[model samples]
Target chain A: MTKSNEYTDSSRATVNRRSFLKGSGAVAAATALHSPAVEAEPQAAANVVSGATTITLNVNGGDHKVTVEPRTTLLEALRSQLELTGAKPVSSDGSSGASTVLVDGKPVMASTTLAMAVTGKNIETVESLGGEDTDAVPRAFVKHDAQQCGFCTPGFVVAVRALLNKNPDATESQIRQGLNGNICRCGTYNNIIKAALDVVKGGV
Target chain B: MKNFEYAAPCSENEVLQLLSDQSGQTELLAGGTDLVGLMKKMIVTPDRVVNIMEVPTLKNIEAVDGGGVAIGATVTLDEILAHPYLEDYPAITDAILGINSMQLQSQGTLGGEILQRPRCWFYRNGQELLDTGQISGGDNRFHAIFGNNGRSKFVQSSRIAPALCVLAAEARVIGPSDSDIQMIPLLDLFRTPRQEGQREHTLLPNQLVTHLVLPPVNGGLNATYEVRQGAGPEFPLASAAVSLELDNQQRVHQARVVLGQVAPTPWSSAAAADALMGQPLDAQAAETAGLAAVEEATPLSHNGYKVQLAQVAVKRAILRAAGLETGGL
Candidate 1:
């Protein structure tokens, strides 16, 4: 589709690495404080409902309440219900890993996880990274043209962001192991690695 | 995936009650990595999925009373990989590192990793359990080489099962009632599923695996080595986990060797362990032990190469455990 780097000079863009991390860290702390209050007194049978039930999902620092069938996966709910199509649903098995997302600051295969399982958990998708965070991973991805077909880019960006959040100083081998869950059919692994290293060095 | 009832219980009592009522119809969901894939494949369509991820007690890795470590059932593989205490258990760390993909390790739990369904493509296909026997054995390359004498040929595909077996880990199980708790040796956890109704492990329908306890590794050198088709994620063609207790002169005082992806269970090799006993873990001893590890292997037509691969894996694991050279040897 002739994709090009749209956001140049991302280092001077909206949020630098330090401020971005500080903002997210504040948000994470506030969320942690509010979590215990959200479920102080656990309900008895109210927690064990049958059939298609209404549930609350905390996604992207916001509360998303959706009524879904019990079999609905997080990937299905995000794409079909919430219309968050940034995370691609490549394979139902999740081995392709085009449905990668951050669950409580960890990279989880959303397609393989049930939506009901992540009731109070924080879910961050590629769509959630555009604000004050100004995630450098996506910019680095564009800088290197790490993706060709682009179907796998969102998942890679989210996966790389999660990896860098945990291990900003990840080595080359660690970087390869960290992002091994996501796949690129276009064989852009070397470029992807380069872009991730850029983000790690430039501070994501 | 088929529409089903879902429940996330907060306490152990709620979990046991739901499991007791549902029995065989309920599928306990941990990290949902394997269970969701099985559901998508229509292999297991449970009436209800009990989400046990929130169960407070099952998500810990702590030190037991002894010098051993107790890993809770819900601990993720990524947590285990990043754990500071894992450095002492090279067999475990190396075994988990051989898993290839970070996504599987991150999303997958210790309980889910060990209890994962077989990776046999034929088994995971849309064939019904009863109809699985109708296959007249076409392209049995990925099938079992050690446990193929029975109707089933699927090999267990766990990265940590063999390592846990060699380390003499034990599983603490909690049943429908608190009084029903039982401790089982890790090696006894697997058996050949001869019939459609039989599962790979002996856990009862109402029972839940709580923790895995590994005794203190006292002055033993251990490691896991695997042979795979590629650097990306593929089931190991053959793998070995070896633990050796050396005497003052570096002679093998005791050895525990286990092979994975070669049998219906984590195949423990007394012959290989015996071969290493009283012998220095040199190249000759490693080679002899490797050959002895596969002495009983009856390979399928296409999987005969797995025996040689398994031999190399055993040799490499032995060498790696002993802190010696492995590539040229």
Candidate 2:
């Protein structure tokens, strides 16, 4: 098994699943409430952020400890630090929506969100969608051939799950609008629409 | 993106003190939707980043003593849509709905939306803000037509600015010190920067927007209409917002018409409003107001198409506010 400190490629993560140290927990409370548990010292208030700080990020119901500076994006923390490379970094402007993840069940672009800002929130990523067998959404994608280059597949799957999770009986137009953030540059939109519509009809 | 220090200050005093004390550029990270992209592109490289997301007081959305509502600065766009009084403010809702991206609506904040930098193609792709030569000659179809000149031609990218301007919203600002606080009109917040150091907004380095007080509509009708190229995640080429009240005789009494995304700021069209005053709400009135709104518009070399789009947006917005069929797609 690869060491915990070392970067473990996700392709080998499934084989060594038991060796993983962190698992998702309910440890982080409402940290953003009115009296902060961690107070800013009066003297160090001005230069509080001197360098990299270690913080716990709850991703996919697992709390993984990682050291990150202010510049580290949530997408970086997931793909680089934890080696959950499911979310693709296709665009920095976040218009592609390939790096989308759910923060407290609301879909947000992981590339746009700072790792420091999303400390205690429950983050759900593409890795959390199901096991190696694939879920109904992925099955629908395969049945409809929703992907061309397969670069935008994982993001579309996660976004579709979040959309369905929020609204079970979403209309065909609603599905189209909700998943507009995720773009298929290869123009596999027709198939993707078919897959999303199939899922909306609850026929896997 | 350049590495920087991060501080999630506990109280408002600490936030202001840190802003005042930071010798270098300290950019406030509220929603991190816009600023993060700017930082990644090296458009704005702040030496220090103060995470204001965890600031407790800035998260509350409450109704004031009067019929108006005071929404906190950091409140997300999705939160605003879920508000109880959202139905009454169709102008604001329509503006927010124009931002079709769910991720953007979920993560973007109200304060950050108002202060968005120009999304000019030339400016964003490693050029100066006022580089008009590139805009005049290059792929300038998306460039501003209403406020274009030899200088800055980039349009204000905020979709919410026109809606708020029509509503006559008030902005509450606080910074540098705990006692430092002031309220100003939302329209007064923006300006077309003329110099190297001036910004598109009037806020100083240390000033922070705390909240916005949206005045009660008070039996007023308002709506927003935008002309877009696609239904997907695309910026509007031209948009308009109209707020008006009818007199006892069913004539337009008071009116405010503001155009969006076709100027440096929310272009308040007094001529359009004047065209509606003491006039009936009909297709002719809407057409007259639409024409009047575009009278001062000076479309650039490649953006003449935007003039017709802006005129139609104004007419549709005016008709939509009056609950009439706009006859527009």
Candidate 3:
């Protein structure tokens, strides 16, 4: 097992998963309020974040204790600190949703979200999907040949999964609106939409 | 983005204290959709970042008395779009939906939406402002036409502000000067930046938007229409939001018409409202109101097309609000 301090390419993913599970229970209450009963954020008046500090980000069902400055976006921490490079960084402005991830089961642009802001929140990335068995999202993408360059595929998959997870009966218009956040420069939108629709209709 | 000190204040009081201490040097991090991009472009490099995402008081969206909605400043655009009650205010919802993309809606907050920076290419490229301390006339195709009297011609980018203005909503603001929160009409919140160096909002750097208090719809017909360059997430070239309260005869009793992307702020047209008052809600009346709305529009060199687009948007919005089938104009 890699030590928590080191974030090398080989052992980055493993380190977070092992350490995260142990500490997740303690910080769960401080995270965002899940639906049906939305509540207030934890009131810790003394918790002033300044300078560089070690932040525990619960990502992909793993606890990633990474040291970062306040300006480090969740996208930066995911790619550089945890070595989860599935989500692409196409635009600094987040006009392209290439760095999308699920925050509290909702699709959010990881590039625009500060890592420290989502310290205790549940963050699901492309890495968490299609674990041992290939999931339906990836299967449909492969079946439809939904990607040309594949730069935006991960974000699309993550976005589609989050959309279906929330609204399984999403119509074509809703699907289009939901996935509109992501952009594919190669113009694979038609195929990508087909892949999502197929998964929605249980075609794959 | 430059390295900055970060603070995720859990309470409103803590945030106020941080703002007091850091003042102009601190930038509040709500959704970070616009601020992060600005930072990456070096448009703004604050010394400290105060992350207000965890402040629960600033994230509430409760229905206010008299059938209005009191939206917490930190409420995300997605949350507002998903609310079932917002359906009554179609103009506001449609305008909010037309902004950016789904991912941006997910990350953008209600407070931040109204306070968006100018998206001019010259400004974004870090080109120096003109000697007059404003954006002098150049290639201003995407700039404002109505508010072009000033040197800065950058069109205001907030899609929500125009809708909110038509709805007659008010903004709840908390500042260091006031012991309690202050409520100002949403329209008064926006200001034309006189010089290039000036910020867009009337609020001070230490002031924070706490909530957006929407007035009761009161059985008004409301709608919004936008003319975008593409079907994708591109910003609108021209957009309009209108609310109409009709009498027993279906004649317009009251009207609030507001246009976007043609001015430095959401431009409200009293002339359009006056033209529609006591007039029969018909195509000709809507057309007249549209024309009246753009009478004051002074188009920049390359943006004469925007005036026509703005007219169409207003006309269509008024017709749609009245449940009239708009024949292609």
lDDT of 2 by residue, B1-329 (tens): 98877788766557776674433388888777788888999988778888878776677564443456667788999898877655678998898888988888989999889887789877777687885467777878888886666477889999998999999987877756555566779889998877544678888778778777777888889999989998988899999999999998989999999999898888999999999999988788889999999988898788889999999999999889888854544
Candidate 1 lDDT over A21-133, as tens digits, reads 22233322232111121324343542666677889999889998898788888998899989999999897888888999989888888999988888889999999877676
Q: What is the DockQ of candidate 3?
A: 0.23
Regions of model 3 farther than 4 Å from truth: A1-46, B20-24, B128-137, B325-329
TM-score of each: 0.89, 0.90, 0.89
Scored by lDDT, model 2 comes in at 0.80
Residue-by-residue lDDT tens digits, candidate 3, A126-155 = 988877977899999999999999999999
On lDDT, the candidate that comes out on top is 2
Model 1: pairs clashing at backbone N, Cα or C within 3 Å: none
Per-prediction fnat: 0.48, 0.51, 0.50
lDDT of 3 at A32: 24
User: Which residue pairs overlap in candidate 3's backbone?
Assistant: A20-A63, A49-B6
Overlapping backbone residue pairs in candidate 2 total 2
> How many pairs collide in each candidate, listed in order?
0, 2, 2
